[model samples]
Target: MTQAPDKLVQSPVVPHIVTELPGPKARAHLEFDKLWTSPSVPRAYPVVPVRGEGCTIEDIDGNLFLDFNAGIAVTSTGHCNPKVVAAIQDQAGKLIHYSADFYIPLYAEMCAELSRIAPMKEKCRAFLGNSGTEAVEGAIKLARFATKRQNIVAFLGAFHGRTYGSVSLTASKAKYHAGFGPLLPGIYHAPFGHVADLKWFDEVLFKHLVPADEVAAIIVEPIQGEGGYLVPEDGFLQGLRKICDDNGILLISDEVQAGAGRTGKMWSIQNWDVEPDIIATAKGIASGMPLGAFIARESLMTKWGPGAHGTTYGGNPLACAAAIETIKQLEGGLMANATARGNQLMTGLREIQKKHPGLVKDVRGIGLMIGVEFDSHEHAAAVEWASFQRGVLALEAGMTVVRISPPLVITEAEAATGLRLFGEAVAEVAAKG
Candidate 1:
C-alpha cells in the first residue's frame, strides 16, 4: 500500500444506504430539477451528489458512491481538495473577478506555472481562457494566423469541443455537428491511427489528404477522451509530428481531458516523446473550476495582436488561485499516485477480462485514463447501469467503452473497492448474457 503524504487532508466518515437509489428524497429532488432545468440535458444517475471528499460522493439521499468518474475527469485532485478549497476561499475574500485587460498577479503566476510544467516547457507560453472550447478556439485561431493557411486537419473519432470553431474540428459523431451550419471552412478529416494498415497514415493522411503548402495545422488528442479514451499506436504521434513538421503545419494537442496529471503525468503526451507546437488543456486545470489554456512557443504566440482575442471572464482570480495550488499539490507525489493506481486498475481489469471474456473485449489505457470496451453499446450501457446499482459511479465513452478515470487523489483502497464493485456488476451482466 502506498502511504499518503502526512500533510494530505483526511476524508470524512463515509455514508451508507439502506434503501434503493433515488429513494424518495432524490426522486423528489429530480422532480424539482425537471421543472427548473432544461429537458435536453437529462440527468443519468438517480442520486444527486450533495457533497464529495476524497474518492467518494455523498448523495442527497445519503447514498455514497465511489467516484470513478471524477466529475468527468475534471476534479482530478479529488472533491473539495483542502489546498484548492483554501485557495478558492482565500481568493474569494480578496478578489473574485477581474477584467482581462487588468494585470493580475494570480493570472501571471498561473500562466508561468503552466508553462513551466507543460511537457513542451522549453517552447511554451500560455494563453488563459474560460473553458476547453475557448482553448480550442484559441488554438485554431493561432494555427490559422501563424501559418497563414485555412486548411486544418483533424482525426476521425475526435471530439474537440462544442463551439463553432472547435466543433468544426471535431469528427467523432454526427449529432455534435448535425444542426450546426456553416462551420468554419477548409477543415478536413483523416483516419485516427491507421488501425487497418499502419502505413496508411503516412501514404494517405499526410501525403494525400493534407498536403504541405495548403495545410495550416493538425490537431489531435494525446488520448481520445470523449471518443473513448483511445490510445493511439506506438509511433502514430511521432509520425504525426514528422508530417506536421514536413508540411510546415503546427500540431495542436487537445489534452483537455488527459492533461493536468490525469494520465499519471502532467501531460498525456509525455507518454510519447512527440512534442506538439500548441497544447489546449482544461477539465482538470483548476481541479474542476472553469479554466482552459492554449500554450505555444513565444514566437508562435506573438501572431495575435491586442484585439486578436479576449473573453469577459477568462483567468479569473478564484480559478487562478485554485489552479496554482492544484499544480503545487500535483508536483510532489499525487501524479505518481495516479500512475501506481492506474497500473493496479489495468492489472485488475485484465484479471477480470480473463474471468468474463465475452463481456469485456479489451482493456486499454495509461495511468487513470482507462477504458474497457464491450462488444456493443447495449452491453456497455448495461454494465454502466449495473455498476450504478452496485454503488460505483463510472462513465461511458463513445458507444461501447466504459471509462474508469477516477480522481488522482483516490487511495489504492478506494480503487480496489470500485474495481471489485465494477467486476461484480460485470459478472452479473455477463451471466445474464
Candidate 2:
C-alpha cells in the first residue's frame, strides 16, 4: 500500500487558523468572484481555498480547514492526488483534446476499466460525457432508443442533474423547475425510499397517467444526494427492479454523488445487491477532473448508431488518464479506508445525536456518504456555519440534513478531528435552540 504523505496521515494541530475566517486575502477573492461569477452559484461558507492536499484545504488567507465536503464529494482520491496529477500531466504532454468522433486509446481504456468494475452482471459498454448531467442525458436517450419507449419515472427528492433533460427528471427542489416550465414530456415522479410507493406506479401512475409499456426508464439515486443522503429502506431497490422488469422498463441508477468508492462499494447500488440496467456516474470518477459516463448493458448500448450521441470533450485524454489513476487509487485501499472511517464518523455522530436528541433527529448513511438530519433547516444551517467557523468544511442537503462526505483518503486522525469539530458545532447549535 502506498503511504499517504505525512501531513495528510498525521496532523497534531490542524485547522490552525492564524487569521479570522475569510481573512483579508480570502475576502478580496470572494469579492472579486461575486463581481464576475454567475449569481446562480451558492456559496456554502466563506472559504476561499487557494490550495488543497489530501483532506486539508488552505485558504488564500493561510487559514487551514479539514475538508469534510470534498467539493461536494467530487475529490475521491483527495485534492490534487500526486498519482492522479502525474497521470493528467503525462496525458497533457501527449494529447489534451481530441474529437470523440475519432477513436482515442485512453477512451477505450477508461471504458474497459469501467466495465471491469461495473455492478451489473451483463457485459457493459460506456458512453463518456463531460459531467453528470451529460451522463444522465445520454442514459435518457439510450433508454428510449433501446426500449422504444418515451416516458421515464423518477423518484421525488432525487437529484439527477440540472440540464434540460436531466433536470426534467429531477424533483429534489421545486425551484429547480419553477421558471423552466414546459419540461420534457412523459416524465413522472414517485415518492422515494418507500417500497409501498412503488405500487403507485402500477395502481395510479401507469393506470391513469403514462402507460407501463410506454415507460422507458425509472431513474433513481441509490442513496439520495442533494435530497439528503437518504438510504432506501430494505426491498425498495428490489421493488424498483421488479417493477421495471414487469413493465420492460430500464432502471438507471444515478450514482453521480454516491458512487466511485464514496459508499465503500464502487457503486452505491451494490449495497442493495440490485443491479440497474444503466449507471450514470461522474463526481468522483476522475478525482476532480471533469469527466462522467453512462455505462449500460452491452445489448442496450449496441442499439445506438455512431451518429446517435456524441461529445467533443467527453473522453479528453487528460480526464481519461486521471480517471484511470483515480480508479487505481480507489482499488488500492481507499475504498476500505472509507468503510473504516465512515464507521468512526457514524458512531461519533450517533453519540452527538443522543446528547442532543431534540435538535438532531436522525443519523444515517453508508461509508462516507453520510447525512445527519436535524429538527429543522435552521438548525442544520446553524451547525453548518458553526463547523465552518471551527475550520471544518461541511454542506447541507435536502431541507434539514447535513451531509458529511470527506475524501476517501482521509486518515484516521483527520476523521477523528472532523468528528470532534462537527460534534462541537452541533452542540453549539443545540445550546442555542
| lDDT per model vs. reference | 0.84, 0.91
How many collisions between residues are there in candidate 1? 0
Q: For candidate 1, write residues 315-410 as lDDT tens digits.
A: 999999999888888887789998999999999999889998888999999999999999899899999989988878898999899999999998
Q: Candidate 1 has what TM-score? A: 0.94
Collision count for each candidate, in order: 0, 0
Question: Candidate 2, residues 1-433: lDDT per residue as tens digits?
Answer: 1222334323457776778876877777777788888998767878877678888887766667999999999999999999998999998899998778898999998999998999989999998998999999999999999999999999899898898999999999999998898999989999899788778987899899978899999999999999999999999999999998998999999999999999999999999999999999998999999999999999999998979999888988999999999999899999999999999999999999999999999999999999999999999999999999999999999999999999999999999989999999998988887
Q: Give the candidate number with the greatest TM-score.
A: 2
Which residue pairs does candidate 1 place in steric collision?
none
**Which stretches of model 2 miss by more than 4 angstroms?**
1-12
